[model samples]
Target chain A: MQNHKTLWQIFAAPILIGVLSSIGLIAALVGDGWWDGISWLTLALPVLLYFFFVLRRRRVNS
Target chain B: MLLLCITGLPLIFHHEIDDLLHAEVKPAEVAPGTPMADLDKLLANAMAKSPGQVPHFLIWDRDDPNAMFVSVGPTITANPVNNRLVRMDAHTGDYLDSPDVTGRFTYIMLKLHTDMFAGLPGKLFLGLMGILFCVAIISGIVVYAPSMRKLDFGSYRSHRPRIVRWLDVHNLAGILLVMWTVVVGFTGVINTWADLVLKMWQFGQLAEMTAQYKDREVPTKLTSLNSAVEVAAHAVPGMTPSFVAFPGTIFTSKSHYAVFLRGETPVTSRLLKPALIDAETGKLTDSRDMPWYVSTLFISQPLHFGDYGGMPLKILWAILDVLTIIVLGTGVYLWLRRRKTGVSTVRAIAQTSAVEAPLASS
Candidate 1:
């Protein structure tokens, strides 16, 4: 394992995902059409990321 | 909490489930701009169908504008909680079918999800649990920081022992879904207080609005329901009638018909404004936006249900709900494993960050 990372480094991805999820939650509530599309894309990020990480086999040499 | 998640999963697709499970009369297909049948005629048809039942509320179906619902109970003063909904055609003023929805799968799931068949106290208890769930999520975030310090985000050490692997899954899913889980969970808690909030509105704002009519007895000769809604529509420009609470029901005073109107936009559609029409004269008495608390409850509903954005959003909600179930399951497993080894979860997580040692050796 590498040396201890800063709090920002540890939280960067989570904070980003959280903000995007919040946007997704409110976007569809505000309007329709493109708003709904935007919400679907933003909200799908975490679910997609979850599957990508859990299913992808890690490289051995890295 | 597991029960809540499991029950809530199917509820995300409740409309589709209900359609698949039950057969009912369909509204006749009508061309565009076909003027709806008069509200009075529709009410009369529904009343004729259900003998000895008194109408409590007339509701316009949000999903199916071609049909409307009349909620009726045994008596005017009876609790509207168990009132039956009679479906009527919007354009023809003909009684369709009144399916007893209490026995449906979705209804049972909803009852379990909301109150577990225990009424108000059960709802309040679930709300308290929801609050606790929110607190746990917040605390989980704090604990996540140290555990993730040495590992990259989304790092799942698949080769590690079961306990360590699950801890990673829990952390990854938990962190990613922080916003959604908290919003849905807390909004669910807000929904539990709906009964109390309506009671507050009835006594506070509704009372103040109709205080002048407090002394008047419920009109023996009620005016036309059609005109009351028409007056309400005129009073609230650019809005459509959502539902009307008949006089002598829990939602209105004894002498005024409360016509609730909704806006056209997506956001405004959820927020309702009530226009009180004098039941005797069928004239507009008063109109006002709902108080903030009631408005909050209304806004929180869609956020919790994930029904606002159509089918795709509902599917996403179901997936996220399943992920949450996994999170909850892993959390329980971790706790049980920790107890077996006699180590607190926080310290175990802290130790994992330092040396990457497996917590459970199998």
Candidate 2:
């Protein structure tokens, strides 16, 4: 189980990231105007959050 | 890591270099009726002086007073190597000496960065390398997930092996640049097939051009290509001409001349482009903004390369590229080390007595 991650934890980051990215992409298609401003941040947030959560879990266990 | 570092460094400053080398000239109002014959006469006399060539495309100064450019190639070849752009007076046929294209550092950098002079084959090869780079980045992330399980996002456990130090750097770079690398990699793959993309765009997006001219009066009358060009300037004010596609060429219809315009701002910069002019009357009949896919390609260009922002952005790009190179080196190193260790473990097991070996190994 050392390498195993719970289903929720494993899927959480990707799902959240996917949703944000999808919003940005749809906003881009629809000319939402505001999405253009924060599009990069939207794309990066999920990946960063995933890293943060995983690192936090590791530190607590150690 | 090494590859990332090198490419990242150049990617960071590509825009800066572009800005440093060229000054923008916005087009000024010339008489709508500026005779194209004058521009053509100037170019014709200039080309005749050169040993052997015919013109391919003509470029006009978008902003300068009395400036035009003629890009020519040997009349008989499709090869781009023979192509040359001759700058000339727009109103007079006075030839401006061709800028020294050879021996320029920018040209050398572009050649190495794009194709390494092997041309298509080299581009295809580099594209494959870009894929390998993508794979290395992905795998580096996979390995890092396990090691960083207990550390903070930027935490470096210095007490670990030299390989670990390198691995942490590799992981951080790969993770940070995951999206960027994918975009650049995919785009680089598409660019390797540049000729195909242009052909596809011509036939797909501008299918209207072909249909429009099919029944129209053909502009076969040699109305100095430059005249149609000036006519376009009259129609589209503040538009600087980049390249012109002639009638009967694959890029245009029999009745229209196509002129590409360059954009002026950081965001509009990549999107500045093609306007269609009536070949016969020198009227700006129609124009094309970049399609979605092409626009995506354009915007992705700066993000993927990290070249749009100023010097600070460039430094960031360089750091990221170096990190990618390190990731690649560490990946290769890790693979080799794993293989060696596997072999030693097998040897040690084989040398032990049967019961003891099995027990010890377990």
Candidate 3:
């Protein structure tokens, strides 16, 4: 098995990102009209965060 | 997989792009609450200019104060590809403009996407493509089950090689999106062959509803379009009119106006406005919810296109669609890599598994 940090590096980030995005998506679907703008951010935020997490993890692992 | 990825991506965003681009589309002026008779007169005047063709459908803009569009075609025919468009002043029914839409981008893309632009051949090819796409999706799911069986849902084994890493991502996306993708794909298949589908549905359920009317006195003096629209509106109060098919069209008997209304609710958005007016009396002859297949068509549109929740929903659809593209690309990559490794790509899963059983089972 890999080190705990490596495991976190490999899994936690993506899982967290997916869960966060899913929440935002469901909220956008069922949320009040006032929260509409935040919905787009919710969809886009995960993709951006995932990229950052991957790049930062790569640097640290090296 | 390739077909679904390509076709599904555009479908997912069709609403977004159409809305963004349609802002430039200038709507013709229409008089509010114009009587159905006057609207019919206006349509007649508009059709008089287009001489050789008979009117098919009349669309009034619910939002635009003075805008109406009419589609006309050669008499005694019902092919979607061969129709002509005429825009007129809704209040006066005077022909304002008739853009030569024979080879426009929108029409071209629609034709290509729906039927491959080969007419019957194109439609048949697209039908085949839809079938193949469905098969690919099923096969993809079959392939996913074994791999996903070992790993937890959404799990990604990143310690594997690049190909395996990508493969896990592909599997996860595919399995998660399977239900949505299948819904969209099946509906897309139904839509691509809508003319046939509608006919089949109509013949099945509508045959009973229309059986009595078939023998009734068919009136030569048709009720004006204006009255018919009014009668339909009266039947379904608060429903917004989507479009109205004039008499002598496929949507209705030679003596009726079929006004398709839309409900304001999310559920109603897919159910559609259904009011059939007598051809001669311009009065409501029948009003009811759409038949099952028609309702299926109605609801499938927003679900397939992912246009339900507005801009945010569209953005989410686009991202998911892009991810799907990546998954498709990775699948192709894995196949190519296996080929490079001297495995024949044509082998059935069973045969391939037999050979690579030792490798894959591990």
Candidate 4:
């Protein structure tokens, strides 16, 4: 397994996604259209990623 | 606190549940370009229903287009418990349901979620709890970072010891839900302070807005409510009147009516534009954007309530809420389990001998 780390992993990703989720929540409340789309995607990102990884690993192992 | 989250999950889906439980009979569809039922007629009906009482608020539901809810009270500053609420067909002026039964239960859930049946002190106490919860989440993140550096994101070490595995699960879920927890928690804290904030506005901006009319008498022979609405609409172009606050209400002065208008877009819709009207003349007195303090509270509501993106977003909110409950439960579990074995009789004995032996040697 690769042990290398990057700046994005250490700093950018967490902070960016964290801020994005907040924006998405606020925007969704502001009204609709693209705001709603952004809300759906950002809010769903984490759990979606978790499942994505889990299913991919299962398939590979099987 | 656990009870708060459990109760809050139902509240996230409160719209669906409330609609289903207290469904009003929809008014029959009218022809295109049909004029709305007269506001004056509805006001009269509301007054007739509650003799001697005055109308506090007239709320038109934008989503339903033909539904409305009105609150009538004995006084302008009457506590919610003292108000009589009625829902009606806005287009037809027909009483769909009067003497609300479901409203009490819904309000109880809100009060419980808000202050646990206590008032301001309860609100302030919950605000402190929210701050502490935020602190816990922050400290958890700090402690979690080093472990995270070693493992990939979403790592849950099933093969590890029970506590360690739990720690991993806790970290993953907590981090994933961190944005939500912070937003909800922070907004919740703001909401707990909403009453105080509104009072501050009343003392400051509202006072200034109504300053000119302070000496005026309570308006008795008022102008038409429809005209007041029209004046407010004209004052704010491209926006629709959301509600009307009658004279002598806290929302307005003793001699003026306050017509609250909302914009079509999302951001402006939450931000109310209030136009003060001359109660006797049906003429606009002053109109301007509400101060930031009041608007901030208004904006915090939907963010806290998750009422934006319909069913899907609410479902997402519920899921995150459940995940947070798990994280919180596991945290308490780990702490109690460690305390039972690590900090009790065996550690006490070890500590005793260690202290005694060191003293004796010295």
Candidate 5:
């Protein structure tokens, strides 16, 4: 069976990475505490999204 | 170029790597409200370490109070690279004979990443490589558009040949990394030209800052180092100084001390605003935000280093850096893979169909 990704799945990586990086950037400029927490989450997001690529392959293999 | 950026991965977490190696010199944590160490004593202690040298700057870490970094050189006008740095115990004024972090592997990686030990020419060559990298990124995007228009973004086909699978993943990763790669690339290139920007700042902004004091006799009797810092801090309320440049240092005016203050917050901390103060009087002489070029250089620092955010951001940068290496490697692989494969599968079929259609019509 062929793997056909939805538009959301296709666009997910760039959108999440770009938007979160922007958010992280904004949060950094907004100062610390809550802003720092937001910055950390947003900046760490693309790395987390990467795991989706891994899990999808694993599911297909199993 | 791939190797250079790959080497920079460890450099992204240099503080952590350095801390792991030199745990003892991590600046002993002191009890809260502990009387801060005296700057003058620290200076005397530091000078004793290297006699016959006049210190260029007295630096106290805004975040850590346990140690001081005192830079000294042959003369005040010497280039900063010629200066020797001595770290002193801020509390007890004790000199720690420790493994220098600058001599460690991370530093080597930094040298490899920045200049390959070739100095300015090497840096400029790397800057050229960075521009090429930007060009590659732009071309890669344009090249991927037609293929990606038909296939959904990130459509990696595993059942296909190995090269094809790699090709698909390469495009996916390349597209994902476009923004990040471009931003980092531009910032990295800008960072390489830092020396030039600083020299320009000295030629223009610093000249303007010290214009009135030009041709004036160098101040002989200096006031309290602590007092100059206080005056600078007072000039910009609620902000602490990052470093103090003594009267003769390149950063300071001839007759005034340059007390550079920084905001405690993440954003403002990257920007260092210098408050010029009278060397003999400890009075604020001039205070202004850094010029745009210098500020751009400072802001590019966090984007290039990825240290501004935290450990998590560094990890993210490392991951992306790895992916970028793969993208670069696969790009070469695909170009090579085409050598044996001849024309692309789509183009081959199109050519065959063109001939077949003519025969059928005849």
Candidate 6:
């Protein structure tokens, strides 16, 4: 069996993404204009990541 | 949880859908500096159309500055839940069509999303489910660690068996959406307590604010609604009126008009401060920032609705919602698959991570 990954290795990306998502959620609530833009970008990260991995896997398989 | 997600999908675009489905009377276009029509005139026009119905609330349409809505019910003491909204042009005081929105598609979706057509008990039950959903997300996170012990983040084994692939998808999606699901879910739970929270405000802060006039009867003659609004605005300098709860409504005392004013900042805009005006005298009775619980409800509203950040954010919200649906779908599939094979969830997760384990055929 492959060496077991540390908890940090497993959770590092998720924790970062969670922090970004949190910032995104609160950004738009603080103000509009650039604040809203920041929110849109930050909140879009996970969704973008999801698509990236899924489509990448599909492309690799094909 | 699945029902909440499915119903919530359409609600994310409820406004856009309502605009497309319903033929609404558009407010007339006017110059930027054009003064808003007198609130009294607007109230008069609205009441003229609704005859015996009493106005419970006057609301400024958040999306449309040129239009306002007067919520009217059959009687002063009647429940405002079934109130008819009379849309009036802000500049001209013209009566716009008040379509029976309760019969609309978006309205139906909203009813289902909120309470499953089961009233407060339904709302609380759904809230209980939301609590469980939150707990599930947390426990999912805990199990996620063990599942990922042998796999990298975002690892999708496309060549694996259906169950294994699905387990990966569930883990990937669920972990990625942890913050969003928890925030949205917890906020939804908070939103379920909105009615109760409003009741608490009424009995707590609202009652305290109007204690001196507790025994006062509903005013026989109401002062000019326009002046009362002006009084409220002047009382609270930096904030603008969000809505006005008319005299004898649940939001205010029988003898007062509760003008709920909001600030200019996005955050403060959600946090409303009420300036109660004497209905008979057209003077500010009391003005105070809403208590913490009420403020929490207000803040939770936009967070749950995903309406605060404009179109792009709403689109993102829809996508995230869809991702959540996938996570839920895969989760159920994994559970059923485990049940069929008589394998524990943790064991399945652990086995799926180990490539040397014998491939389990579907």
- What's each prediction's clash count? 0, 17, 14, 1, 0, 0
Model 2, range B36-75, lDDT digits (tens) per residue? 4375687676687666876666766543546777777775
| TM-score for each candidate, following the candidate numbering | 0.96, 0.66, 0.73, 0.88, 0.87, 0.97
lDDT of 1 by residue, B72-94 (tens): 99999998879999999999999
Question: Model 6 clash pairs?
Answer: none
**Largest DockQ belongs to which candidate?**
6
Question: What TM value does chain B of candidate 6 have?
Answer: 0.96
When summed lDDT is taken over every stretch of 10 residues in candidate 3 chain B, the lowest stretch is: B344-353
lDDT of 4 at A51: 56
Alpha-carbon runs more than 4 Å astray in model 1: A58-62, B345-362
Q: DockQ each candidate and list the results.
A: 0.71, 0.11, 0.14, 0.36, 0.31, 0.86
What is the RMSD, in Å, between candidate 5 and the native fold over all Cα? 4.7
Output the worst ten-in-a-row residue range by lDDT, candidate 1 chain B: B353-362
Q: What is the interface RMSD of each candidate, in Å?
A: 1.6, 7.2, 7.4, 3.0, 4.1, 0.8
Judging by TM-score, tell me the better candidate of 1 and 4.
1
TM-score of 2: 0.66
What tens digits encode model 2's per-residue C-alpha lDDT throughout A1-62? 14555445443443455566545333332332454445545544534553564465457656
Candidate 6's C-alpha runs over 4 A off are B345-362
Q: How close is candidate 2 at the interface, in terms of C-alpha RMSD after superposing the true interface residues?
A: 7.2
Better of 1 and 4 by lDDT: 1
Instruction: Between candidates 4 and 5, name the one with more favorable TM-score.
Output: 4
| Model 3 chain A weakest lDDT span, ten residues long | A1-10
* Worst window of 10 by summed lDDT in candidate 6 chain B: B353-362
